[model samples]
Target: MSSLNFNLQEMMTVAASRMLAADDVCFVGIGLPSAAANLARLTHAENIKLIYESGTLDTKPKTLPLSIGDGELSDTALSVISVPEMFRYWLQGGKIRTGFLGAAQVDRFANINTTVIGPYDAPKVRLPGAGGAPLIASHCQRVLITLRHSKRAFVEQLDFITSVGFYEGGNSREELGLRGQGPVMVITDLGILEPDPISRELVLTHLHPGVSVEQVITATGWPLKIDADLKTTPAPTAEELYLLRELNARTQEAYAPDGLST
Candidate 1:
């Protein structure tokens, strides 16, 4: 295996998965977050419990579940509950350690837009509306956002705010009566962004291996902030890549035999 697997999607997933730890009890959503969380479980953080909104608790799906309701998830779960109980007891009860979710569009404050692409009244691309994202963002202990980084996806402002991140910053979530710590980190294809402690703004604190700072700036729609002491992300290790590919193979064979790769 090549030490330099410049596959951006694979790199991004690997980077995101590293954020998990053995003790974490994560609330995972579909797509990138799902793959990343599953990768974490398969490799290093085997003890990281995964909870899906479909009421699956501690799901150990062999492949990436098609949806929260995917039987493979429930089949491997430690226990299953109804949607209401899942929300009331785990998420709203603040038992979830991290809410790992994806976003269509994101801003400097980390606010997400998964509603529409154009004006609200009459829009262009109509995206998947907020499912449990709003509440999950509100009550989880902390949130980790995953999205592809492009000028279009990383917008100056959202067309419709699907999930609030920092809002207007400075204790805004508290003011709005929303619990949780809001967004702590945003993992993207280009790099990793984390909130600045003082400003609560997402700053470009790290760059993916072989990616330039200028490239990240160019991809961002807004004027991105740079950390004075930025870090360069380590290239994916052979073990990490191997495990990720194995996981991708499993999900593909189970969900998309036609030829889909995570």
Candidate 2:
């Protein structure tokens, strides 16, 4: 497929989608994370169990959900449970394998900040506070973070740490007894970042079709590390693109202002 046919967001979503396996149980977050998780379900990970914080279990939405509470989630879900059961029994009990998340700001260690952009007391941008992300990050067996790559979003220090990713890096998360392994992959428009085996700091492991190592480094707020054996992410396949575009088109139609499909 020609590169022009797909944009960076599509590539990012596809790359993130590929991180899941058919047998995985994914705890999904909203927006980009939700899109990537659903794309995985529609394509490679057909049997992947998708659970939402809103208590929708095994949801297979034909169209992307606008929020956790979106009717489409519950409508297509295998079953609906209470939020407490969703978090306590399923999430904290270690039933979740992959935690798909998005963050407003992410530090070098993959520490997520979705609270405030500036300061906690008086913020430049007040983002939606952490929902189930903290528990999702800490309890799931592993996590996959997806967001646009930029110096602002990829920060040296977050305004506030809403979800712990490796905490202070290294064995810090282990020290704190966080059950999950923390973020295993951080997928972005430019490429993929993985935590170093020893240091636990995020490092550039793969670059997208047209992205460069310098571009990834420049986009990061901190002094990013480059893997010794860097790789290029395979461009989105025709089937992947077809499924993603179809899903998006359906979403637009479902949300059309006149309640009509254009």
Candidate 3:
């Protein structure tokens, strides 16, 4: 075993970023999804249009946003519209090419949970309720998810389904009349999982550098399946690592106790 230059989180973010194309009109959620989308914009997908639920369109933030309502998003956006217009016109109208999302918990079917940790009425830990996630999952041409791999986060059942993935799996999403293709790629610290075309069950398709199939399976709460043509995800390149580090450093500085960086 040898050491790698980048950490697993960096590899995960870079892997998720690579899924974007230069011309994509992406709806970005906060946390890992925001970081990954911005990384794509700063690197290969320079022309990618980033739409935040805060009503900022084509926002090019200098640092990672604290939330969708972060001032920098509006400050850097090409245009700022009303929330209704943002959703009704841009999202539901089918102008969004991809939706990058994050989740507190996810199941084998790609269903997401961010509402509560336990039973809804009396929960162990209450999480931020779903904002625009459900609509994004329903209307965007496609959806991409990023979250750390862990038994707790990758669960057998969600405490609550904040957003529909494949729903019950198979043609369930289509049967329910969801316009977008449900979560296509789920990028995690350990590897990348993609929904099977036929069954709609998440299958481990690519293992990150230094990660093993056993490790990924052990981290997942469900009986995770393996892709017949499994592959290894290429480690983050020097440029990608440098850019990611710089972005993170800037974010830390911007959100420092004193004030945002100029």
Score candidate 2 by TM-score against the native: 0.96
In candidate 1, what are the lDDT values of residues 98-213, reduced to their tens digit?
A: 99999999988999999999998889999979999988898988999999999999999788989999998777767899888889999998899999886798999989887889
Which structure among the candidates has the greatest lDDT? 3
The residue pairs found clashing in candidate 1 are none
On TM-score, the stronger of 1 and 2 is 2
Clashes of 2: 0
Query: Against the true structure, what is each candidate's TM-score?
Result: 0.95, 0.96, 0.97
List the candidate numbers ranked by TM-score, top first: 3, 2, 1
Regions more than 4 Å wrong, model 3: 259-262
The 0-to-1 C-alpha lDDT of every candidate, in the order given, reads 0.90, 0.92, 0.94
Error of 1 at 60 (Å): 0.2
Q: How does model 3 fare in lDDT?
A: 0.94
